[model samples]
Target: MKPLPPTLRENRRYLLLRITPATLEADERELYFAVSDAVTALFGDTIAAEVHTATIVREGEYLILRCRRGREDTLCTAIATIRSVNGTPVHLTTISTSGTIKALRRGIRAERKGNSIICTINEAERTGILYADEKIDLIRRDMKGQDVVFLTKDDMEIFHATTTITDGI
Candidate 1:
């Protein structure tokens, strides 16, 4: 009998560093700087050197950042994105939320209840949902007080906070 070929798996390690929540009215850019500084301080000049990309996504009520590393086979080569709510900066590492999500898409339980939806996201992912509806409302208002983007009942299952209309007038 022929043996199955060994599948190549990337040998990579990641670390998640979470920051405490700060005040709500704090500046977002400033908070990002602080979180970046903290990440640099924690990982030093070696592993956490390159920051490939950073993106902000709305999860439930909170804003989550996904930071992608340049390489996948290095120690401390990971992403760190943060959200500042009520003057609090919550740092979420790629390993904790993103990794977990990648591991168990079905394991992370979620269900809808009436007008509200309940998702069994991890404690860290929960950060993404923090202040979710309000933040989206703020963003919508900031976008000219139009209902172009909204949170609907179906969005609850996907953990997405904002919805947009590209074809509608």
Candidate 2:
């Protein structure tokens, strides 16, 4: 089968969003449903179909969503209405929007340019990464599962044995 030519192909835009709290365990399917529901709820089924919202890629706490190019505004509005996914409270902040996947991927790389610091709190090991505004994201993994904690630099300093600065993140 022949593929559609560039001019005949549907125009789409990719939106990069940063998921806050950044620790939600929701999978791609859950995220898609959440987005779909938000769009439908805000614009109804017909408009939702017209928007054709889809999840293109999910990397760590960043998500790339595809939607009809001209409908991006409506989609962004819908995305803002999404407050939770799978019963867990989450906030999605749109980082950037682009017509090419390459540009969006570059943005993701730029956003993840720093190494993470390792810390030991109450004898449990956790990996910490510094974010802007003096915020830190810590992830602790154990036999049970993974636990993610977001705290300020001041709060993290109170933890015990948080002196190690691991190399290569």
Candidate 3:
């Protein structure tokens, strides 16, 4: 048996997306169904079949989707438009896209201190605990390896840590 030639082989594109309001757990099958349904509903089955999606993986809060090249626009649009999964409202935000798996595997830029990310809150090395009613929002990314996470004093009912910088992300 022989592998297909480079020219004859299909070109693939990878899309990185984040699911917000992390109320639901990561399930690839359900995510796939949601994405497929969204595409079908938006552009019909013809376009969905044409997209030639190979695989979909849910890593943490990120959903990495691999599909045929030249169809990234369609796939990205479908992912962005998907409102809910398993009755939980999830907002999908595109993080990055790549043509190769190696490139796609490279995630957020940060400095690693042992295992966990070197998170600093209020200019302190060790921050305090978070309350159940607290809302942690992104203040701003000042440097390449430093991330400033602000735990707002606002009392919010629904608070979700939807994004996390991790391995294989």
Candidate 4:
């Protein structure tokens, strides 16, 4: 059978979700199931069938979900209900919703480019990468240990170039 023409096709919307911690590794299939379950449990079979959410892209800590255009809100609400994936607790923050994947991908590129900076912490220089929700992850020398610091973009001063405030100071 021939594919449906643009005018005959159903309208769809794409959602970009940022996986919290940015380190919790999850499989695409597993993630899809988790989302499907959330939608089904929260809205029941009828709405779930109408939404027909699908995970189209999974890049690093980001996931692109597609659903019928009008059901975007419903899908997002279902996504908010998800608490864990494969036993790992995680929070999926909806970064943006777009009508086209190209636009969302462009935003993701810009997002990944500028959040990193070199700063001094504990007299040692570390690389800090900021997340969408005003959180920063400082990478250690060995890259084995990372500390999540909850701070906004304006709070970068905490990691001063030459000095760090100590508890006793």
Q: Model 4's lDDT to the true fold? A: 0.76
Give lDDT per model, in order: 0.35, 0.83, 0.64, 0.76
What is the C-alpha lDDT profile of model 3 across 32-94, one tens digit per residue?
Answer: 888889988998989999897655677666678888889999988888788877765678887
Tens-digit lDDT track of model 1 for 13-106: 2223333221133344554455455456656655345542233432322334434433432322323333443334344443243443244233
Ranking by lDDT: 2, 4, 3, 1
Task: Report the CA-based lDDT of candidate 1 relative to the real structure.
Answer: 0.35
TM-score of 3: 0.64
* Candidates 1 and 3, the one with greater TM-score: 3
| Poorly placed runs, candidate 1 (over 4 Å) | 1-23, 51-61, 69-96, 99-169
In candidate 3 the C-alpha lDDT for residue 73 amounts to: 93
Per the 3 Å backbone cut-off, how many clashing residue pairs does candidate 4 have? 0
Report model 1's TM-score to 2 decimal places: 0.29
Best by lDDT: 2
TM-scores for candidates 1 onward, in order: 0.29, 0.71, 0.64, 0.66
User: How high is the lDDT of residue 169 in model 3?
Assistant: 12
At residue 36, give the lDDT of candidate 3.
87
For residue 132, give model 3's deviation from the true position in Å: 12
C-alpha lDDT (0 to 100) for residue 125 of candidate 4? 73
- Candidate 4 residue lDDT tens string, 45-148: 99999998899978988999999999988998999989888866778988899999999887674434326655566677766665566555554545443344
Flag clash pairs in model 4: none
